[model samples]
Target chain A: MVHLVIDGKGFQAEEGQNVLEVALENGIEIPHLCYHEQLSPYGGCRLCLVEITRGARTFLSTSCTYPCLEGLVVRTDTPDVLRARRLVLELLMPLAPEAPRLQALARQMGVTETRFASDEEVDDCIRCGLCIRACAELVGAEAITFSGRGERRKVEPPFGEEALNCIGCGACVFLCPTGCLHMEDQDGVRTLDKWKRTLSLKACASCGRRYLPFAQIEFARQKGEDPPAEGWFEFCPDCR
Target chain B: MGKQAIERIVEKYGSDHADVLEMLIDIQEKEHYLSRETLQYLSERLAVPLTRLYHMATFYEALSLKRRGRHQIHVCMGTACHVRGAARILEQLERCLSIKSGEVTPDLQFGLATVNCVGTCALGPVVSVDGEYHGHMSASKVERMLKRYSETEANGVAVCQK
Candidate 1:
């Protein structure tokens, strides 16, 4: 455990705990988009910028990737930090103009308008890599990934083709900060339109309602998972 | 010969996953570009994920995922080279090839690309063909250079020009 001061409030955190997690755990909100609990720390989104003074070195770093140290002084809303964070948000404002999450965060940070934002309808994906991380780490599907670089950098599956290995898991859609990735279940088929993957939904034997994709159950079984009872997966949670 | 590179790369760095980039580079050196089939074979032989390999293939400027021309042409577009009519040289080359700077002729005879600098800034407007470098280039010289490689077998590489 290590002692730290965030916004002048003292707190104790685990040695390897990143500053963003520590601050959020203590109810000190630091705006972020790319940070996920189950996935590894990826500071792709610069919204979590914070000023840290460790001993004598004072620098601006993304709190999500900056691990807290003993006697570390963190300032999340400093003029310098806000300036940098707001600048990142401003750059994203136009890239995803219709993203509610981005708009709400901009309003919270007092960034009403952007001089850089163009009136062009562009993709809502901010390219934060959360979906990619979730697919690889959590889902173990490795179905989605990032391709290209610089201006062309984007999260996509292999060759931007339909993902054959994807089990139609909606983890990526659920965790997406901007809601750019979408999935829908209709006609007993689950469609991940973003990945161009469609899977047949498993209808409950008892309730006769689609609850999960069959591929997901097969994937879980292949990973050495077993149902609680022999016929457990035959019914939905409510029916069980 | 192409399959041998992958076999050798896997034999050498089979256990070390950190050297996947090195393996890809070695294969690209021998194969010119990374095809989908080659990547699939590498993924299975090396046990590395295809997404990770695809990331590196698309990420690095040095690695190419598509088949290149029989001959590779690299033009220096550095600050010094640009001032010495490198842009004109590139434009002339494009006009002759009927393709962009980063494009290959549909005949697969020539692949034209621009390099930042080859550290030979004094010899500004430098163009590298295959592994050979020509210095102090102008728009007029592009045709003479293309004549040397244009007659080579479009399906094969290396007719050995001096």
Candidate 2:
């Protein structure tokens, strides 16, 4: 464990955690977005800025990326830190006005409205790169990637082709807090609700009972695959 | 097999660092990662020596000359992630996959790595499976995630179909 003083409050935190982790662990509220715990630290949004002082040398850095050090002094609610955070919010507002989290954070920071203007109209990407990095770094499909360059850059699958490698895992869908990426179960192959089904009664011996699309099961069986077990029902009410 | 390709790359940029990086990036993208053959061809054409090129490639994190598995799992260990149980999620992945960080599965289906951050702190405890982020993850969630991918792989469906 490492000891640090944050916002005039002394606290002890586990070693190797970043300042943001330490602050939050100790109940110090620091405003931020674009810093998902699961994704890598991008430092793109520039929110979560904090002031760290060590022997009078104070500087600002995104707490999400700043690793905690022994005896470090940190402040998240300081005026300077607040000023920097406000500027970052100002820049992000114009990019994603529809995002309630972003809007709420901006309002909390006293940025009731955005002064920044963007001539190029586009959807809510904010370009935080959570989806792109997630696809490339975590999934290994390299199915979807960032294409184009600079401001023109957008996440796209290869040749902008319909994502072939996309297993419909819904990782990207869940990770995208902004609801930018959406998925639909056209074949009625229900996997997203797998967790919910686990809590319900077991289905027929042939097919698990929670729910199964009849057409989909029949299609699978017609393809020479085994149908649901003896006790398993053929289809859910919707399919029937 | 083709001198024309080498000629095209060399003639266009003329042995500069930026040019070399760009050429390597193109080659890497084409082949998925830099191969020995591609590096040799570059070394011969650029006349900058293979050792120097290797050094430069190693210096940049973006470039990977080594063979990468089909899937790369980069768990974010950033501050926000750490507080939000990213470590537990990573541990779950490692346990379920039966591999340590940076190790590819014996079947060549997956590879695991940890990244400092990817800038989405709002979604703490994020897990990127094969470059797709799965946010707000728990140990159970990670297990289900791996099972889903493994099932897809078992089904012989190209894990990344596009």
Per-residue lDDT tens digits for candidate 1, residues B1-162, read 366767887778764778888888877877778888888887777777888888999999879988777688999999999999999999888877777888887867788899889998988889999878899889888777777766745522332121
Query: How displaced is residue A172 in candidate 2, in Å?
Result: 1.7
> Candidate 1, clashing residue pairs?
none
Query: Candidate 2: where is the Cα deviation over 4 Å?
Result: A136-140, A187-240, B1-162
Alpha-carbon error at B95 in model 2, in Å?
64
TM-scores for all predictions: 0.91, 0.50
Task: Report DockQ per prediction, comma-separated.
Answer: 0.79, 0.02
Off by over 4 Å in 1: A118-121, A225-229, B1-5, B116-120, B131-133, B144-162
Model 2, residue A88: distance off in Å is 1.0
Residue lDDT tens for model 2, B1-162: 245665566677766645888887666544446666776678767764454455445545556666555667889999999998888888877877778888877776777888889788888788787668888888878656766777464533432221
Q: lDDT (0-100) at residue A196 of candidate 2?
A: 19
In candidate 2 chain B, where is summed lDDT lowest over 10 consecutive residues?
A: B153-162
RMSD to the hidden true structure, all candidates = 3.2, 23.1
